[model samples]
Target: MYDFTTFVQSIGNFLHGQFSPGVATALEWTLVILIYLALYAILGLVLVYVERRVCAFFQLRLGPNRVGWAGTAQTVADALKLLLKEPVTVNKADKLLFNLAPFIITLAALTVISLVPFAKGLQAFDINIGLLFIVAVSSLGVVGILLAGWSSNNKYALIGAMRSGAQIVSYELSVGLSLLTMVLLTGTLQLSAIIETQANGWWIFKGHVPAVIAFFLYLTASIAEINRGPFDLPEAESELTAGFHTEYSGLKFAFFFLAEFVNMFTVAAIATTVFLGGWMPFHIGDWAGFNAVMDFLPPIFWFFLKVSAVIFLMMWFKWTFPRLRIDQLLKLEWKYLMPLNLMNLVFTAILVYLGWHG
Candidate 1:
């Protein structure tokens, strides 16, 4: 007879013997949470500086140079200022939910980081359903946005929240569809498994035309999902006066701002994992010498390089494009992106069935 409990206990005992159970558990959870928090803080500062520089380049002007070495410390200073500033609650607003919303948004952003594989074997949790876990946790940000908007008791806040809810919901379908194509091709939903499948070649290359199309669809859907420019109808400055966070001041507002930048990197990381081969290095077709050279570089470097390129593309979109109207946004998603994504998934399935992948 199969002793399921004993079998499970044996496995647990094995793991405990290999790694001190109490210490390993504590260290693993701590490292996961700390890495997530540290990445947000560092990336938030870098992105703010990069955005200013990029915007300045486009406008033909010098950007922030007053603070520590070309305004690198500007975000840090801004963070300190926000921390010192007092938070104000509107008279008619739901105080608890209103205050809780920003924290919720921030937490949601951080939670998705756990599933992201920074390098081979570097992921915090190698959950079998890692990809699905990410999608589910990321969607929770919408709830936070809705709560924040509704609790503010401001008309603009309500409008922003409603727009965000609709926009995120529509865009999420395309994102999911794009990911489904990858899952179908790889035959597993685990992030690490997806990367290993791409060891011989990146999915964007291996899966051919369908994968390429899915990549673009994923990019567009991600931009919309993050509520970045073009799809930034929720925070339309001209109309909503800062949108859902209009009534929030000081540290509360800063939390919302930080969440946006973190969300941007989160999307970029997902794109890296799905399409660009996570931390897999470049390889030439059967070229052992070139592949060996590529392997010398750390996995984290490849992961960062891919993610940074995606982030730059996003920043370019933000600075270059004018915001789209809400209705136009929905029309683009439903009429174009959805159909294209579905077709890509079908094509990917055919390729996988035919063993055409590299």
Candidate 2:
């Protein structure tokens, strides 16, 4: 029965079963938007909270304990502070672009949420070209960044924006390759199909060393893509004093900030789905007892565990590695990851062709 010809038809079947087709269809669309919006807000709050606690753990300091039990409410407070502030504007800045940029970036990130599969039957849309769509949509945020920096009419902001543009554009190559490496093995570009291909075991396990390498490669490039910590040259405080967003304040600034944290979740989710089997629980071939134990846990739990592991690793990099010089950052991408990824893809293709992937 789950052999859905299309995701839209699947939704229609479920909605029609519940109520009048007309009302159910309208309700489905309305609820989907609300859910996505709630998810967007919740992602920012949860990420900020997690990042603070994780940061404190590394620094040997108590984080936001005073705000709300163990600082749980700290992000909530921060959100309120931003929401209440007056948006400031510079006279010389291009008001139109400055105002439009944050929305563009935020929308780009939000659009990807609908394309991801959180669970087997849970997703907004399951398109055939999910991978290509995600990559394209994910890259559109750069335009907003460029506009934000340039429109601000501040040289520092402009420089920061340019740096961010260059960094994301370069690292995206590695990200694509890292993902394509796994796709080569799985033989599908569909996100849901890729996850299903790993029903027996995660790619990192079945595909072995090459898959492991691609995972790390993707992780590093993702860190740079999100502009976090060491790869955060675009917003280097000591250098650009907040960089491209220096002129941003209030809700506008919040949008940019929200997008960064949400983007972190986006990459982590993609990594989880590609490398760790999306919402599929782990299973070891021929290990009946162990497989049963794994199956006892919900698929969503397995998915979260994998994504959390990836997110924690990213946090570790942020807390440990010092910011790389611009030259070093670019070199790491071009001289290192790019070559490694290409070679890995070729090798992976050979392995697939020989039926040796498992």
- Quick one: best TM-score, which candidate? 2
Query: Residue-pair clashes per candidate, as listed?
Result: 0, 0
- Candidate 2 residues 89-184, lDDT tens each? 998999999999999999999998788888776778789889889988988988888999999999899999999999999998998899899888
For model 2, the superposed segments whose C-alpha errors exceed 4 Å read 1-24
| Candidate 1 residue 347 C-alpha distance from true site, Å | 1.7
The CA lDDT at 237 in model 1 is 96
Q: Give the number of the best model, judged by lDDT.
A: 2
- For model 2, what is the alpha-carbon lDDT of residue 32? 87
Model 1 segments more than 4 A misplaced: 1-24
